[model samples]
Target: MTTNEPRPAMTMRQIREGLGHIEPGQPDPIVQTTGYTVSCLPEDHDERWTYTVRVSYRGDGLWSVQCRSQYVDADGKRSPGFCWSRGPQEPATQAEMDDFDAEQAEWLKAYRFDHVTALRIAKQLAPTLTYRGRTVADALAEPVA
Candidate 1:
């Protein structure tokens, strides 16, 4: 197939049918539909399919699903969605979270203000404003030289 050919659009039922075997975390009672619509390009032309995954969650909180796989096939075309096989679960560890936080903190350092510049800007913007119970000017007042 050429890389520019357009594939037929997939039906919603066909999309959900692929999700029958997926269960994320504990079996949640509510069912929600997550969809995927993708474009595929072949060596010359493209044939594509839109695959989707629907998940059920308990009817009272944030609805989410974690999966290992992320794609499905329809009409010989491929699309990405939730598609996970039950297997050895890789638990997200605290060290990973800590590393993420440390990276974020380092990234945020670029946005931290220089005391003198921040104080000057704050004074010009709102001389008497109290940002969080303390006056903005007082909070940013110059250090004794």
Candidate 2:
């Protein structure tokens, strides 16, 4: 019978029954999207100045890591800021996955202990800020201390 009516959605019980039992500690068949950010103050900057390390999945077996600098003035005015993204990388091997984590950690460490160098590296990676006519990279390039 070909009817124009929409099919009813399957209930949870019916779906689970079709899939059978699942073992404990087993990875889920469905892919999960995950992300996190680590914020830290620059070695030489005051409380208003800080940076963040971001790691996120960009779908289709790809991941990305980014670092960004932020600032807020005493009047509570915020700057557009500048940022750099590393990759939408596809790690085909376990070693490559490990390298990804290591690289992100290294950048985090740089921001914590060597803010100037980290900003320099980020500037090199992303030369222009994609905001309004004003580019925050110039502000970031100026001496912090």
Candidate 3:
């Protein structure tokens, strides 16, 4: 999820498409948008800015869209984080990006993937589940009545 590369601002449609591809029509899956600039960072200095779009679902479903950037500093040090300007000013350091990374990790750990999601992914990767000599669907669909 961390990239040292820089990219251009992305449109809303593009963001939606990217999310769709990742989760398809899943009822509960995290979606992220491509970063966009509310303003630009100076070419002479490294700065960062971040925006988090929180999405909540019923029964403790928490998700967020995080976007960031990195820019070159006057001292030739590369600032690693989102580089956006609010009110025509850039962040003085990369602290924001560091903080965001830590927070994101914590959130992910707390909101780990669900059972159905795990099963679905496993099924998609392989044709059959051989856990007990039966496919996953077969195993789950066994009569319990």
For candidate 2, the clash count comes to 0
- Which segments of model 2 are wrong by more than 4 Å? 1-12, 15-32, 40-49, 69-145
lDDT of 3 at 38: 29
Give per-residue CA lDDT, model 3, range 16-126, as digits (tens). 768775444545556754222221222222221211111222122322121223232222232343323233232334573254455454434443234344233323333
Q: State the lDDT of candidate 2 residue by residue for 57-89, as single tens digits.
A: 434443344544332222223333322243543
Let me know the TM-score candidate 2 reaches against the reference structure: 0.23
**Which candidate wins on lDDT?**
2
Candidate 1 ranges beyond 4 A from true positions = 1-98, 101-107, 127-145
Highest-TM-score candidate? 2
Please give, for residues 38-61, the per-residue lDDT of candidate 1 as tens digits: 211122221111111222221222
Deviation of model 2 at 131, angstroms = 20
Clashes of 1: 13
